[model samples]
Target: MGVRPPQNDDDEPDTITFGIAALDAHLERADVEFPVDAETLLTQLGDPDIPYDATGSTVALSEAMDKVHIQHFDSEQELLNTLHPVFESYRERAGNSILGQLRALLPF
Candidate 1:
């Protein structure tokens, strides 16, 4: 993870740097680091005691990410064009993985 001075009060003290582990690896391969502090914001995401499910969390996180990414673009059309497929792909794959895990844990 890359470290940098805080941008503003609204920004996390530590940024997750490029989103998630997978994204981090990809960015690292590309010789880039976005430096985001996902840890600081995780509590805001859900209760600690609740068992974490990547599928559900991915959708929620993706939505949150989309909101921010959408604002980054100058045009609404650009935002939609970029986010739509990415959101859909994440939803499908993450949803499938969650379902698979759920099935594996079932007695049946």
Candidate 2:
């Protein structure tokens, strides 16, 4: 049988990996302080009550970006270009859960 989907969104473990290398590189280039280190950032993102909410249960893209001081962008496209991959990676690694579904439905 193929892989089964999560029965309860809450039951699904949060296993999303933040592409730390890329994130660090980007932050370094931008001369921005990484609000939280890779490990802490991942832990915070896994929590469902850290202020940012996307599906009412996960960290919002804007919130995460803002945490790292990523407020200004040349354009909407530029912002998306910079962060889409990271969000996508989070969803992909997070697996089939309500959070992932919410991420898919909501615009980052």
Candidate 3:
């Protein structure tokens, strides 16, 4: 078990704590650094960031983002299930993402 992670809870299939304090500090720093995904979508919709004009009414960009927020967690479980195999297929794809980069830089 050289370089193996210690078990934290038997209930969990895996436990890989890089350590609470270090992981928390890294997470906080990463939070501020990651870009919001929808910003690009909004920008592409229009310059001056035109609000989302639905079937009959105009909705502000903030309102659109809010609407998206509500829908996000609603599909979390379903999305997780759907994406599980995709994630499993490209285990290293995550390594190319921001979190992966941060993980690579961790001293642990």
Score each candidate by Cα lDDT.
0.40, 0.43, 0.34
TM-score of each: 0.28, 0.31, 0.22
Residue range with the least summed lDDT across 10 consecutive positions in model 3: 48-57
The true-versus-predicted C-alpha distance at residue 40 of model 2, in Å, is: 24
The digit string of per-residue lDDT tens for model 2 on 27-102 reads 4444543434434444433422221112323444445565444545554345445655555555455656766676
**What are the clashing pairs of model 2?**
none
TM-score comparison, 1 vs 3, better candidate: 1
Candidates sorted by lDDT, descending order? 2, 1, 3
Q: In terms of lDDT, which candidate is strongest?
A: 2
Alpha-carbon shift of residue 58 in model 1 (angstroms): 3.8
| Whole-structure CA lDDT of model 1 | 0.40
Candidate 2 TM-score versus the reference: 0.31
Model 3 lDDT per residue over 1-108, tens place: 012344456664543322122223333544423232445433433312211111111233333344333322223234234333433333345556786677667644
Per-residue C-alpha lDDT of model 1 across residues 29-83, encoded as one tens digit per residue: 5442223333323333331221112322443444445345343434424433554
Q: Tell how far residue 9 is off in model 1, in angstroms.
A: 42
lDDT winner, 2 or 3: 2
Regions of candidate 2 where Cα sits further than 4 Å from its true position = 1-57, 66-71, 96-108
